[model samples]
Target chain A: MEFILENILNLIGFIVGLTIGILSYIGFKNTGSPTLFRLGIAFLSISVGFFVVWAGYMAEDFVLQKGHIEKWVQTLGIGIQTIGYFFIAFSHSIKSFFPKSRYLRSVGMLPLFLVSAVHIEHILRSVSFILLAYGAIETILSYFEGKKKGTIFVALGLSFLAFGEFLGWYSFVFPESILYYVSISIKIAGLISLFIPISKIPLTKIKFDSEF
Target chain B: MSKINAEARMVTTYRPHMKIIGDILSTTRDDLHSDGGASVTYLIRKANVSHTRISKILSNLVSQGLLEQVNSEGTFRYKISSNGREFLVAYQTFSRFAENFGLVI
Candidate 1:
């Protein structure tokens, strides 16, 4: 248990990946969304996450490469993480952007485009995390507001996303911090949040008064 | 004492249920859902929704007497009236769907 908890990020990523698969099934079976875009996004995010884990967790910290090259690689890796998070959030909630999800086409790409010189060490990293978190929360809220709201599924997916980010980001910085394991704990919270709500939502059709 | 209705089936020369209605009152629906009621300030937050759309929902319900302004002050909150409640009961389709979903209505 201790060993598994310590590597919770990896575990949660695995679990979340599984949850997305299940959600896609349910969406198809129950809601009739018609395609597997949601599942594709979930799997893709998990892959990106695992890729980061490999680069950070398995790669030799001190390589034979030169200083300039190492910094370039590190920055490149962070860039990949940013792209991954953007799409994960996108896949989680397509409803919010309906009739103009086209706007999202540039949402993820723009921040990278306007990477101005006024920069700090991890400024992009920080800003990206904040936006991703905000986006995830927005998606969850939108799901809740839907007529056939499914708070549980959305919450579960968000848990994985938020924790995946926390773990991956924390590991990016700490690579050796004791708090490293907290990422998975965060992911666990996400899973439970989703699971609990899902079981009930299917039973309720958002009873609204004729007045509303 | 009063509530706005976003579901007016009739249109005032605006094609019914077009973006004219959807775009306008989507925000109203959001505000009402979040706060459990809506006001002018909430209407302002629904900046995307046209004043025309909000008027449609509110006025339709008012004409039906489902909503009425409760206060002399302009800062009145909209709420469901007794007629509205009766309408809501019918709208729920609870008796029909409840049986299908296996619930005791």
Candidate 2:
């Protein structure tokens, strides 16, 4: 049951990410905008990351028949997803990853020091969380500045992803619980929210006025 | 009074590079009444850009095959090429997409 649910969630994520990536790539090809190019790469990386984990699960079930996925496979998928998150955050041109407040900055670094011997998977997860959180904050700031309805959706989507990543990290601490499934579901919801604004693009409504 | 002031402020604000290109192409394609094409002066006025900037942009566009320079009579004029029309369509589409993301392209 767990494997089935996991596969379904990852498959949804993969499909959504792939669609967004293709749209961004098309936008990039049409306009030659560097932002669209970066966004294209970001979504593609995220889609591939989801595919990697789903493939790993399938391989374990069929080829290995191990009844459990390899730790390395999960780690590799998370690492790739982290790269995607980094690009998303980078696209926002975040001046600093850490919070401006000194107290918040200290709290942020506390996680790194708390781990006695940090595993690669843990480090990658932590980095992914930070990047998503930072990207969410930036998107929210943009919303406040621009007050665009579309930006609000983007901000909400990023926030959901960040919260999902935070919960995912907690899932590792309590592996026996249902947090892992919840996190995956939340991330999928975030992807859907992101799709809403993208689907609403008024392509036909755009007019080139001469008064400019 | 305030609405008029806001409109005035909007007019003075600089247009984005892509917007200027779109304006130039639009003026050449739609605003021109004749097959003789748009003169540099006419384009400069319609695009609201300086002579030097429009010259550079026109040169770039012609080189990219987006615009065709025609020597109608004694003066050179520009006509939007088929490529330019395709580019303009794509630009219009992507502009809406980018606007949704609060990005200018």
Candidate 2 chain B weakest lDDT stretch, 10 residues? B96-105
Query: Which window of 10 residues has the lowest lDDT sum in candidate 1 chain A?
Result: A27-36
Per residue, candidate 2 scores C-alpha lDDT tens digits across A77-180 of 88888888888888877666657998998997887888738687888877888888888788777667567788778778878888888998888899978898
iRMS per model, in Å, is 11.9, 3.4
Q: TM-score of predicted model 2?
A: 0.80
Native contact fraction of candidate 2? 0.37
- DockQ of each candidate, alpha-carbon based: 0.03, 0.29
Off by over 4 Å in 2: A96-116, A141-148, A200-212, B1-16, B33-35, B45-48
How many backbone overlaps does candidate 1 show?
A: 5
Q: Which candidate leads in TM-score?
A: 2
Chain A TM-score of candidate 2 vs. true chain A = 0.85
In model 2, which residue pairs have backbone atoms overlapping below 3 Å? Answer: none
Q: For the second chain of model 1, what is the TM-score against the true structure's chain B?
A: 0.44
